[model samples]
Target: MGSVGVAELRRSLDGLLTYLEPHWDFVNCHMVNYLTDDHWQHFVPEPLRLELNTAKDLNQAIDTLFWRSNRQSQQFPAFASFLAAGDHLRLENYEKLLTTVEQLEQQLATSTHTQLSIKEFMSAKKCHEVELTAALIDKLVQSKSTPNSTSFIVDAGDGKGYLSSRLALQYGHRVLGIDANTTNTENALSRNRKLQRAWNGLTERAELQSQGIIPARRGKKSNQQDASIIPPSLENYKTTSRFITTELNLSDLLTEHFDQQSNNICLTGLHTCGNLASTCLQVFHAQDNCRILCNVGCCYHLLREHFSQQEFFGNKALMDQQVDCGFPLSCYLQERKVRLGRNARMLAAQSIERTLAAKELPNITLYYRALLELLVCRHAPHLKNELQVGKVKKFDSFPEYVKKCADKLNVPWLATVEEEELLLLLEKHEIDRQYLELFYLLRMSFAPVLESVILLDRLLYLKELGYEHSYLIDLFDAVISPRHYAIVAIKQ
Candidate 1:
């Protein structure tokens, strides 16, 4: 009916709602298609286009929400440019976008003041075990089939026992935090000592506050002490404990601490790498007394061999003989190119200045390899063999970079024609710098989904093991920390 600018259009559309739309055809066609192509690619299959063509009232509602009256006659393009984004519009993945944006904005705001503070870049949640321990305690308290007071927590692959300390000090729960790193176990003990001192101060302060000796807020007038001096539940208190061992020996360590016949124990982890989470799942299933488990798996590829199902390096096997892998490095690289293309525009504006600041531009291949590394964990392995085994000069241009790569791989010099041929291929793939900015939003949307698959595996494993209340919840910012989802399970 009328023209609406990008600003108004964004205000009207909720991104996440668009994702969760119940009408499969509407979502998969109109919204999903527009996203992949920015409504520009006419090459879209007729079946796909027809899917969006709803003639009923349901179709009308979908069209009004997305196409809108203002966009009624703009002759939307059939193909989108790379990373076709439509602002921060009514996307189905709104909550994640909001959280990541909030954290990033806050971090950016404080950046100028703290040039060297990595903590500013960290998420709002505790990097250590305090938050997780609190969550576990809440779950335990709510369970009708709560285990005996002697029940313990097994922190599998526990690096520095962050959660272990919280469980012991706050909830008064005994915990055994295990890890392969000797230094990590030692540091955990050291940190727990420091945590213990700090906790003592907090307890004393809490007591005073409870007795009306202190104020809850800064400079607030108060007649009585604040209740925060003594948190009603150890829910706020933190614990400290440590146990160190290798992956192969974890099962033995768990068996030593937990009795299979009588003890009611819970196995848990936070960001346990590669096969560590898998090991936890196996241990949970194998141990009868280990009744409740909460695990969040990471490093899907490293769990085991996809086909042969070779046990690369874990005590327990979690994967089937076949690895359910998707998205070869090719798709990830394409998406990344789409992302970097937008960022390159900003760099293009300050190209001279940035080039000067760095004192050298990286070789084109090196830059390409770095971007590709972000998509898939592996890097281009042949480049090093092909290029001169020497330190790369920052001043090298794209051609110079290619020449180095060719020389390192022992290939003959690339003619200008050959170089251009390669560059053209990159452009065709939309791997150029122009697509980076917009693709970040889409990438942000996928972060949670990617992580969900990993976390879901752990929940499913727990469920299959007879722990019915096992659930995966969004406990932290998905964008700010894609690995922020938590796997929480209750003992029945």
Candidate 2:
């Protein structure tokens, strides 16, 4: 889809609000205000509050932050982290702001009184789990009754192969685990092999019982034994059956396998980053054997939004082709239009843990957010050489980190006007931080709905292609694996 200019996009935003207002109202009536109780207190109800607070002034915030006609002249960052306007915001001011924010983050990270909130994270996981499982079971049932086809379980972007191994051992289905990360691919294969060996022993023992060599226990039934249960110690499969391949290229491996056997294949992925999941979807569409597809994808921007099939993967139907994103990308763009705002409250809590661990001041969070905003504007991905977060080597001080970033971004020093300008920008932006935070929180609250849209799209796609026995089911703990939706499309 062509990029809609800010003015036209604002109109589209209004249309979306008009559509979502009723849904917002429904939430307000049924589920909005449960923050008082400890069980529900994890959700701050900030978004609902924003909906109420901005009911009269929503357009004002939009106009101030995102709706200016001049905004169309400047390019926004393709990645979420780099969505700020670097040139418009002076480099010195940006650097100081980032520096200050980093110091604040360091302080936060090294605080003594910090305690992480598991409830908030757990709630988000719980919400996603419900939606994911529903979609998987729905697809599996629809695809079950068809004849003369094997059920091929294909896990794309299979990190460490936890889910893939479980599916293979417990479900008795042949699985193909694909990943771009070689280490992760190797780990997954290793885990699957371990699980496979453990499964083989169970199979052998079951065979022995079937021959009456071993008596069936009183409490345990034959069906229970028949059900594949992986032993904790995977010593048995070390010398026996192997469940998956080790670190093979997905396109080459799948092309060869599918060419030989085309009737039975189901594609799945969990948290496939950027273009990888998109590639999986394209592969599924192109391969005639890929009868069922269940993918829970994250990292939206990595998806080549405007690319045609030929431009990206040399396939035509996988191109955009007037497909409704199903995702509220326009609405998300509207959300971004608000201001230099982010929902790092969860990160804030995590920062608390880091602070306590590091014994540094808690204010490092401010620096991190500030730098993140600057990075968003700068549109630079992979901060390995410059700014680092989440378990990195020690920096002597906040200034040292700033110097590293400044050196990398090619700026010498901060000017007085830049400092003043950056602080002023922060003050101006902070006025609407409450609203932005609310919007972010609200967006997160709707993650289940968002995932549901993706799941439903795949389900409908399969149904449209005449797969009548598709099913979807809850595969595992959503907290442990947020991408817990399992799609089972079978042809018997």
Candidate 3:
């Protein structure tokens, strides 16, 4: 209800942990082998399942309880009450524990308005992120007691240099974009070259739009001519390929690239993946010169948990080289030995709002995959959940899906199974399709709550370090960019 302070964050963390303790299995269960794993019997209570099955429109019911209805206002069904009373899984209670995006935004007065145009180069979502982030960085730079014109921004995990280009070109700030991939660095430079050429036209279009005047569409020739009109040199925007870590010194890197020395620095990343976000925070704390941090992290599935026994998703050699884990950055979670398993972390990445808005459901391939698991048990027991049958081409029927999967998995025994048997298997489990869909929706509903825990942990980490100005700003529209909250801090 109030701005999420340390005390409030701690309380919310405790409440969320308590609420989620009982449902870890449901969160962690692999949907690929739902039936084979006996997930329904193990996790879902009979009464709730029965109620869901009996609903006239299960899709509508899922939408109502999961997305459309708020805990306090909505008239809940009998199943909802059953979940709350018997299982201690109350949507209303969970909602109360979460620090809402609105609450986070209210803590800082940010302008949603952007000076840049949504040109054909960037999506509306990306345009929004870059403009907003650049504005915040500008404000942060201005707020510094000893604001230096020589101050530069360090864009970590700066893929394709969207934010970096904007900061350098539009805001007149020196930006150094660092990414792990050399290809990305090259591509970012190429993209920036194009952006620099069309910068004037883009700004003019944005200005016209602000004044309620839509710019006229230009022909291919006109567009080419506009692109040929190169703006002044953007030597300020430099990029490099380096996998960033906490130990990586920003001051030294700045000197290496720009051939200039400046202690005043703002470290930023737009949707920095997994450990890179954590690295940005660590780098910020490690370097005295790094005064500001604005990071939006994504790919929670890739986060290396300190307490988790699960195998790290990325290069294990690289992970082992890391000094710290991605999760439990705060002393509170670390002391408690908190662990959100890889499966749960993957679930946390889901977007319930976007799913509901699109009226989307899990692909039929999900059901097919689950069914494939059944065949794997019968034919190749050793290969059950072991086969890495990734994405398959679209198929018209279950038998076709099986053949394609078998070929991909190199499971000759599975491929040999008769088509009639596959059809019969499909017919027998016809009702299970609905069950799995419902189960998927129910599991996805917990996404935001799980995400809140992760985000709060990062915020709490900053708080633990005695940074008074640290904030978790909900900077973008949830539907457009699910990983919207920016972990911002201005070191005093």
Candidate 4:
């Protein structure tokens, strides 16, 4: 699959879009609309309906759609088949990429990259993301076509400099971590300083232990803990706080940190958010010095679709440019003027495997929200705006929930609605709750398919530009880092 180039990705992207176009409403629609909207059933074929009805358990039916092959004709054939198309989007055939630290101390490759687990520094998932990304960035740097090209990393949306810090401190790369938020930049710098001191102290302690001077503590093995952090020589790990707009220049930004003569940059962003991922690609594409790109994107809901039915989020003037605002980057979809709405993008961000493995049921919050909508309709019809009951926890009863919502919305009339009435409303809509959960699972099954559309669009964009070395490497473990696909492109 490493040899599989633009032609294959273009073909894959086209096919995925073809299936998704007509079924867009099915894959993208909200779970809250389950009972209200009669249209979801229209998307499910007759065969699927028959199978869903005959299932031993509704959740088991979901497992059949999500975990196993959807091609089975035994039951839920149509729905299962629909899900199978999504499974194809998993990048099962792509090349697995690994990087080796080539410096003298790292001469002998003793092992596959050791997992970094630093407490107080980050979550286990975050630790996995940073380590894996640094190694891949190492590969991208060494793999550069120009052997003499001095590699510097421009970390786009480098929130708290986790990846930037690792690359700069451990890998000895000159990293310029950029972020939209000023506070993040300041915090990252502060955090980097503390981490450096910790590493400095650990290095001394480990050296003493190795010299057979400092005795090892019993029941407290620190060698395993020490391996993750290297002796920190924080080499100019800098941050520039700014929003990554489409017009941002890499060459100009690099000149600010390095000498004006500096060139040969590798643009990398860990979990580049919303339109920023697309922004990173555009920056990589536009800048001559940006010879390599490794981007793992997240926050799909924040992406502004070029062809979306919803309002585009961000500066309207930015949208006026030729860029697609991260949607339908492929020429095939561009020709058809394809658009994925915000809701659709949000739905795409969900993880079916993680959700099912962890047994994450639909939050009762949905049930509360739906019932509140009904209450709004019956009692406060004049209230034009929707009431947002944010994160109500440990309520004794449904009436208490209503009172709190009423108080928040400043709707005194809700007090008049009795607890008996609220219970009756729950009684009336009890079946809707079950239906919502079932449909939520159905919607979740399309998660990977929708994400594939977004990722493949980016991959095809590189191919469209005539770069052949580009590949989508499933970089991190999905259970650890949900946004695991890294778009690696090298210009020949």
Q: For this target, which candidate reaches the highest TM-score against the unseen true structure?
A: 3
Candidate 1 lDDT over 312-367, as tens digits, reads: 22324433322332111122222322111211212211222123233333344434
The digit string of per-residue lDDT tens for model 4 on 31-95 reads 54454454347555566566654325565665565445346745566676766666666555333
The numbered model that scores best in lDDT is 3
lDDT of 4 at 171: 68
Task: Give the Å error, residue 217, model 1.
Answer: 15
lDDT of 3 by residue, 377-479 (tens): 9887888778777799878988889989878878779879999989999998887887788788778867877888898888888878888778776777778
Give the TM-scores of the predictions, in the order they appear.
0.48, 0.42, 0.89, 0.83
Model 3: lDDT to the true structure: 0.78
lDDT against the true structure, each candidate: 0.41, 0.39, 0.78, 0.71
Residue 122 displacement (Å), model 2: 17
Evaluate residue 198 in candidate 4 and report its C-alpha lDDT on the 0 to 100 scale: 72
Model 3 Cα shift for residue 204 (angstroms): 1.6
Ten contiguous residues with the weakest lDDT in model 1: 113-122
Give the CA lDDT, 0 to 100, for residue 246 in model 4: 57
Candidate 4, residue 61: Cα displacement in angstroms equals 3.3
Candidate 2: worst-modelled 10 consecutive residues by lDDT: 340-349
